[model samples]
Target: MVHLSHKFSTIPINFIPKQFSKHLPQQIPSQTTPPFIPFSQRQNQRSLLESQLISALNCCTSLTQIQQIHARILRKGFEQCCYVLTKLIRILTKMEIPMDSYAKLVFNQVENPNPFLCTALIRGYCLQGHVKESVFVYSEMRKKNVLPISFTFSALFKACGVVNDVDLGRQIHGQTILIGGFGFGFDLFVKNSLIEMYVKLGFLGCGRKVFDELPGRDLISWTELIVGYVKAGDMESAGELFSELPKKDMVAWTAMVTGYAQNAKPREALEFFERMLNEGVETDKVTLVGVISACAQLGAAKYVNWIRDTVENLGFSPTRCVVVGSALIHMYSKCGSVEDAYKAFKVMEEKNVFSYSSMIAGFAMHGYAYAALELFHEMVKIGIKPNKVTFIGVLTACSHSRMVEQGRQIFESMEEKFGISPGVDHYSCMVDLLGRAGCLEEALNLAETMPLEPNGGVWGALLGACRTYSNPDIAQIAANHLFELEPNAIGNYILLSNIYASAGQWNDVLMVRKMMRERGLRKNPGCSWLETKKGVIQEFFSGDMSHPRYGEMKQVLEDLLNRLKAIGYQPNMNSIAYDVSDEEERRILITHSEKLALAFGLLDINADFPIRIMKNIRMCEDCHSFLCAVSQITRRVIIVRDNLRFHHFHDGKCSCGNFW
Candidate 1:
């Protein structure tokens, strides 16, 4: 309301300072000549105009509206005002308007820009991902002798982070020291941003040194180094810094939660979430996502339900939250509730690549190949393109079900139809699909000749299939490559030995065992886990009878084994990786981890509820047969999730059809 234009009317034309006359516009002859505005009054008028322009820009939601305001700026003869022009530049950047278009034109109109204006333009280019152009602007600012602002160096550092250009970042770093001097007001900001750039570029030691050398540090400085350590998977260092943070915020808490989840320490992630809650830290969607993911990894239904209710209490619903829904789908499926996973997927209001892929992978993991294929088609029909992970799910479904033709078609269409070239993981899936279908030679050929060099997964897939189909010769080829690719992977050696034993080739099995001894590698003990009705996870190790109820568990297993033998099931001597006498092999087979888990589940789990068991390694032949018989005799549905896939046994049949 107190506009400069109204106040100027009360002042006389002759009252203008003589020294200020030249800065104002010249009077015209024909028009009733307006009074000459003094330089101080003009400055006030320009500030008022800029304030009004900022208010107007804030309300502009679209490019067209902002453009109209830009025309007003030009009409008011305020085009050269750096205060107004800098705001204009940033608004355009926020609107995602290209820097080359109206922004550059507006910036070019300012004859001499101050540091603020120059930095704003630099940030505009940086925000648009035009790092080269932003550097060019920095150079021009230097040529014009404009003192760079703290934000100018911040923008340049940010640009370097975007392009991952450490060399350019160092050049800017040198310039900061040369111009701003060490420990200057602007220098701290520049140093902080430099630390961030180095951390983001995967130089943790450099970031640490920068932090250590800083005379004073802020939360942001500490957080930058902490995140750097977290990204490097050095959670120990991250935790130490986090413990030292005086006042932690939501961002820092979320970082720890997500970091623990990403590094496969789900229990630690859950513990952090609880601690954060006790500290009265407000949780956001990001924090909730990390917690949800940890629950998914735990594969516990109680944890899943708690997180779901907690999310709803926090005003987030899986139906409306795509990220939450995707995480819930993954959790439910891993918990042996694929039906719940599908329900979540169906209720989601929005489905992104992650949502569809999670659902597809859930179906594939549960051996519902047709459902996975149907979801893929639906995703395509809805114009949601399949990403690399999506194709992995599709191919995995086909592999589990032995749908060779469908698998081949999907693999071929990856490049031609989806425009995503097959990655190494895709090739691995193809090998798995062909190998699991008893096409050992074809799978081996594809793995050996793929464009990308086969990683451990590719060879591992072939070797696993060799175990299933009893192909010792091809297993050797795969094992040799795996030995070179992953020399320390004891599973590969164990798989090769098992394959040889399956073929009744004891000498080759001895060779594999001898090689393992030579390399100082020992087989990992077979382990299994089953969640109790009370939500306690019970872990079992092969031949470890240390449980409180070990006597009862042994009796249960012996009774079941005797029944299995009476029903014509025999001990698979090859299942024992060691060359031992027949009696020892039978004893070892009965004491396998999964069988122990199965016996415990039968004794403790409710008859109505299906028994869910998780194994760290592949199920052996004798255990698989024994479980099938157990399922028929007890009239129970048994769900066993091994390292590779799920096996659903019901009424003397397995979902994998005795193929896996």
Candidate 2:
């Protein structure tokens, strides 16, 4: 299944990458006059043994068992026998047997290799993420007079795709045409693979041409074309083609759903799934994932519950089975239901590395950084190895807690013990960790030392820190870095402007906003959702009244402000970018996103219920402080999740210690 990474070898069967540990043997085809080996002959006994060994190799799942069989093959000096060599490769590839040592061992033993074995090795390298090695095997294959099969060429094209080498893929496409398989019956299969390769390489126009030229079509062919359209952001065409297909299978349905969900059209994917169900096609785990995701996007808690119940009733267990459980965790997290996510995680039967990672993210999102950190330790104790995502989660926890030293230790340990090099994301998290802890100089130095170019989020993190510290010099550097990478990242520019404004560099702030006008960059509007007694209603920008309870909402806010201020509450209007009278500023701050949501919560909910607010952007410092004060004065629990981490407010204190 495409949903599970470890379950199946997604690498196409025919063009198995050269990195796979299977062996292929070459033997000259005998002419019709030649006599075959007799079953009763002494040499035939060796052939029988070889056949049994190949069967054993095919059945082996563990690398240890494969190695034992491989050692016997080497001991008997049958390593050069193509038949045995090929089965060994199958075991290694299907089982995700590690690369390097075994791959080299297989390569050294193959003598006068079969075209199939050479091609398998070539493709295995790409699948195993050794693109350069796959290319080297192909070059060697050419030298050995191993005429390429269409599958061999397909593997080569895939290698080019892996390395983002479009020019190399084009060269191979020309070779495939010259080799005379361009118009054959299996042409669609080969060509679809080529076109998909180009899509992966980001040459959608070229990929489209290849797709237009294919002579026959299958589900794979249609999937490749649909994926090409989705990659190019032409989901309309992809959707059109998806609708017109006479025969629809799980792969095709999942492909379309994945495309839509990835492109932020989760609702459309859910609708597509409904049409699929109407056609009598029961949803698989893959489709269920997309369905839950779409519901999450809509924030339909009831709809998600229905899907969960159905999944259970259909005999589909939720655990580490595939990606369904992980998706559910994410869905609940995004919908601000961490309790439900925890319930799901607690009952899971088999937990893999990703299982803990998703739960950690859930806790982190809910402002339970302590829980997130504890889970990280639990992951290590249980021998569930950490990956880049696990470290990112830990770093996020440190950032949330303002634990600079803990972040440093984990960052260094990534290189020292794990031997996993920090990618740009890891580096970005470090900067966030340090920046949040008020170590501006160290964070800036780390950003400069990043092995890869820093993306927008890194500079944005630094800029935000500058805003907190009221630093102008480093803020300018972050602004320049951000503008260079993505000139239209409006958030970075606004943050830099805020930093300048906070530093009393009003002229510089004016200049920045002026430049924003010239570039047509507008600040993204803020939005908030308030769950009323009737239903959930949304308000945004400047006190949106699209809700059914508009008049009641206005009166509720008025009452809350009066009652809260009587209890020692005060408005902090420091986030206002423009000049205004003290009273006007205070009045405007009350209408801000979080306050508006809190007002709605005060009037609708039972006195004991907590007020939960989610913001599309980061919570302003003034709002964060105001929330703390509001919680204490009103004796209410206020939970807020902004562009960064969550904040739980109670008794004039925030869970983040007012750091975030």
Candidate 3:
């Protein structure tokens, strides 16, 4: 084997001058061949051998085959061939062979490793989660004065992100500027890698700084910082960056859409998607999922149908695309159409844990405990392991249906059978289950003794249960903890106040209100949205008689109240926490946002379509009973989606069976 001397090592690592190739010894031809072979023929034979070795390495699937090839290379006296060795190390990395176990040994045997060879090893170690080992290799390369390529820094930056070692990343960053000078420092690929690393490490400000300092930037650089801001929940900054981008691609558009959906600004997400389509940008499964999520949040049937059509037109079939199908199931479920969710689930060609969990949760949200339980078992029977979300859905089903014993059995089996340790959410579901079933004392004990600290959801559930059974004492206990845990949550104060009102403890209710005043916390106004037959969404607020059709809506409500009174139905005066007259209480109940939406639905929505209304807060007891009577008297189906769950009213009955 021949080796290059250190005297000529000052040349760039990537370039080996032609003058050096002429001095290398040539492989001897076989004895059967002519000993006087021409120089060009010997060169051709060597070139053919190198090509054949590369092709063989490409086809090598196992380590044994690679070892056999390595032996053949040594026998042919190509041990110092950097090109073939580089390819070999890459293949080993692709096969996920550990760096220290095999590839490092191959690297150690090389007498003069070039830039590519060193980079391949560095990348391999980084990929294998050996960041320190990769850095050590880089240090050795520097000691030998082998300059690194752009990919070397990229690989190191990505590894630092994987291990969350920002300090090491900064050191590598400094080396890029020092060793390679500003030319390499300003390399587009390296800059993008730095931005990605900082973004992934939650240093969005650092990523933005890099972006702002780039002398020349591409769409990739712009999009990296945009995505970084989106991940940090800074949609304002993301939008500003996007506005300044001269060339917008599908990835950038998708980032904004997904960011809005995740941040609960669903309307903005839909609007951005619409603009993306109008600008002639293409949509993919990811973009469609974001749009579907936004539509689900709106919970309007008109938007639901529009998104369904858009999904089909874009060639994303729910039956074929698993992610799109799973998203559709969730969207339909959230839009108050569990039947449609099941339909989408039924047509899917493949089912994973997400699809099953969405279906079970849909059934649970609609109070179909038996259906949720059945699907849960079916998913388990088909070898799909239920995750934490799946158990939450199951326990929620038990809570809604008051299946206390079944819920207890499932909760106990979570860790013992499925190896899924219950999280805080699962504990909250258990508390809600026991609390909803009139076991307030037991639920309180569980919340106090649970391994994890009780969050707002746990105490909130207990307080809600107290309202259900008119237990102000337990409600006070839950509210006290909630006040400390969530000082500014207006819902907690309201829930506690409602419990006091239900128990005729007006003084306690006044005290809660006083505390809210002191904290400058105002109750969120009751708001509802109803879609007209023309697909226009109308908004209504409690005690706000400002709609253009307020006259007709008032007349409709008056007529309904008169009919309800004829049937011996009386107004639930306790629904109002204020110490007002009977007439004032009746007026306030009639002016509730949901009631107004119901009147608008009756006037504008066709009888063939069920009246669907979405509310921002939970429906009051007075409104729930009123809707049940209206559904029976008018012979109509009404669906109301509040903060917690869906209520389907038909023929004087609610799907919740009066338990919600």
Best by TM-score: 1
lDDT of the structure predicted as candidate 3: 0.88
lDDT of all predictions: 0.85, 0.74, 0.88
Give a tens-digit lDDT track for model 1, residues 378-465. 9899899999999999999999899999999999999889789999999999999999889999999999899999999999999989
Instruction: Give all candidate RMSDs, comma-separated.
Output: 7.5, 8.2, 7.2
Model 1 — TM-score against the truth? 0.81
Candidate 2 vs 3: which has more lDDT? 3
Give model 3's TM-score versus the native structure.
Answer: 0.80
Backbone clash count for every predicted candidate, in the order shown: 0, 15, 0
Clashing pairs in 1: none
What is the overall TM-score of model 2 with all chains considered together? 0.80
Task: Give TM per candidate.
Answer: 0.81, 0.80, 0.80
Can you write out model 3's per-residue Cα lDDT over 1-660, one digit (the tens) per residue? 222222223433223223323322334356686668799998997788888678767777887666656655665657788898899899999999888877888788798999999999999999999999999999999999999999999999999999999999999989988975647878999999999999999998888888888999999999999988888899999999999999999999999999999887888999999999999999898999999999998888888999999999889988888889889998999888899999999989999998899899999998899999999999999899999999999999999999999999999999999999999999999999998899999999999999999999999899888888889998999999999999988888877887887778888889987898789886577999977888888999999899999999999999999999999878777567555688888888999999999999999988998999989888888899999999999999999999899999999999877755
The ten-residue window of minimal lDDT in model 3 covers 1-10
Backbone clashes in candidate 3 total 0
